[model samples]
Target: MAADEGLTGSSRVTVFAMFGVAFGYATHHLDARRVGDVAVVGPLTPGVEWGLLWQMARNCGRATAGEAELARWVLTQATRAFVCGSGRIAQFPEQGWKLEPGGKRVRFDSTYANRDQLWTGNLTVEGLAPDQVAQRPTIYTV
Candidate 1:
C-alpha cells in the first residue's frame, strides 16, 4: 500500500495524464452533482481535500458511495469506452487497432480494481501474478 499512498499523496504524472481533453459533456453525469460534490470527469468526482465530505470518506476507511460509484464507472464504463475508442490507432507500436490489415481487438483492459466484477470488459494479460491479482479487493464481504 506504500505505492498507493505515495501516488495518492503526490503523483504529478497521473495529474499530467489528465492535462488536455475537450468534451462537451459535464462531469459527474451532471445530474448527480450536488453541493460540495465536484466532478472531475465523467462519473468521477474527486472528494475535495480537507473538506467535510472527504473527511467522512476518510474516517470511514473507504470511499464513500459516491466515490465508489465513480470508481465503478471509471473501471467499467469510462475505461472500457476509452479503450474501445482506440479502434483506429496503435495501442502499441506492434499492435494496430485498424479493422483492416488483419488488425483485431481482443477487447482487453488492464485496470486494477478492488472487485473483479468492477473490471467488466475483455481479459488480457495485466502483468500481475496470480496471488497479486485483486491486490485491493473490496473491504466488504457481502
Candidate 2:
C-alpha cells in the first residue's frame, strides 16, 4: 500500500514507540534506498510493526502527525555512514574496510580484502544526545 502511495523502489523503515503516556503512538522513519523494505525496530528491544499491524490507525488518506516530529528529530540526531573499498588497490587483492561495532571507526581487513569474503555486522547509530544508541545492520552490494 505504501508503494501504491508513491513509496516505490525501496526504503528502510525504522519504527519506534514512545512510552510514559497512557497510550502512546508509534512512529516510522522511512529511509528511501535501492535496497528493500528493511524495517528495523531495535536489537534486543521490544517493537511492533506499525505499518502491518496498524495501517488503519495510520490514516493513509493524510499524513501522520508524528511525521514532522520524527523528521525534526532525525534531522537533529541522525547520522549516515558509508563503508566501501578504498579503490586504491592496483592489484587483485585490494584493501577492504571493516566497520567497527560502534560505527565510529573502521580498519582494513586483508582476509576480506579484494572482496574475497563478505563482512556482515551491526552498525551502532548514536543519537546526538549522550548515551543514546540505535543498532542497524550493515547492508552492501557488490
Candidate 3:
C-alpha cells in the first residue's frame, strides 16, 4: 500500500511540474508590457494631449484578457485622430488637417493590481510634423 501511495504522489508531482512548464511557456510569448504591473509607451504624433491621453492610458491599465492588444489599438486610433485633426478645435478650419492624420500625438500607461487598469500620464502634442504618421503600432500581451 505504501508503494502504491508513493507512485501516486510521484505522478501528481509530475503533473504539476508539467503544468508549470506549460504555463511558463505560454506566458513567455506574451507581451511584457501587458503582463507587467505598469507599462508606458509613445511620444505619439501631432501632439500628446495629457488629459485625453491620460484617460486612455489609464483605461488600458485596467484592461484584462486582451490588455496589450487593446492598448496598441487605442494608440493607433489616437494617432489617426491626431493626423486627421479630429479631437482639437484648432485643426477644424484647415481642410488639410483632415488629410493630415488628425491626432498623432498620444501616450499609453497601464497598471495592474489584481486586475488591469489604466494610470494617468502626461501626454502633450505640441510640435510634431503634421505630415508624420506611424505606419504601424506595436502590440504585445500576456
Candidate 4:
C-alpha cells in the first residue's frame, strides 16, 4: 500500500518500517546488538538495506525522529566499514578493523591513512548525537 502512497524499488516495505516505527511512537536509545547475529526479516541485508528502509519510511509518512536519524547515519557508516570495503577491505585485503564488544564509535572508515577490514563482533549504537559525518565512501568491493 505504501508504494501506491509513493513507494517503489528495492525493499520498499523495509523503508516503510523506518518511518512507521520511528514516527509511530516514542523510541528510546535501544536496538544495540551484533551485526552478524542480526538478520533483517526480508531479503534485505543490513547496512545496504537501511537507506531503502528510510525511503520506505518516508513513503509511509514517517519522518526521521528520535534515534531514527541516528539509525540512518549508522547505516551509512556500516556501509563504509563493511559493504564499501573501507574499514576492513581497504588496501585490497591487507589491513583490517575491528569493533569490540560494547564498542561505540562515531566514525570508522577514515580514522586512518588506509582502509582496513572492518569487523564488529558485538556493539551497540548507544545513540548518536546531532552531528553529520562526512559521506562519499569509495566502493572497493561488491
Q: What TM-score would candidate 3 get against the native?
A: 0.23
**In order, what lDDT does every prediction score?**
0.22, 0.21, 0.26, 0.24
Per-residue CA lDDT of model 3 for 1-142, tens digit only, reads 0011100000000000110111000000024354423222223333433244434444655545254455455444433343453332222211111111122322244432222322223222232243332222335222
TM-scores of the candidates are 0.21, 0.17, 0.23, 0.21
- Native-referenced Cα lDDT, model 4: 0.24
Clash count per candidate? 0, 0, 30, 13
Q: Which stretches of candidate 2 lie over 4 Å from their true place?
A: 1-17, 21-33, 43-123, 131-142
Q: Tell me the lDDT of model 4 at 96.
A: 21
lDDT of 3: 0.26
* Candidate 2, residue 102: how far the Cα is off, in Å: 16
TM-score-based ranking? 3, 1, 4, 2
- Candidate topping lDDT: 3
Sorted by lDDT, highest first, which candidate order results? 3, 4, 1, 2
Tell me the spans in candidate 3 whose CA falls farther than 4 Å from its real position.
1-65, 90-120, 124-142
After TM-score superposition, the amount by which residue 99's alpha carbon in candidate 3 deviates from its true location, in angstroms, is 27
Candidate 4 regions exceeding 4 Å error are 1-65, 89-142
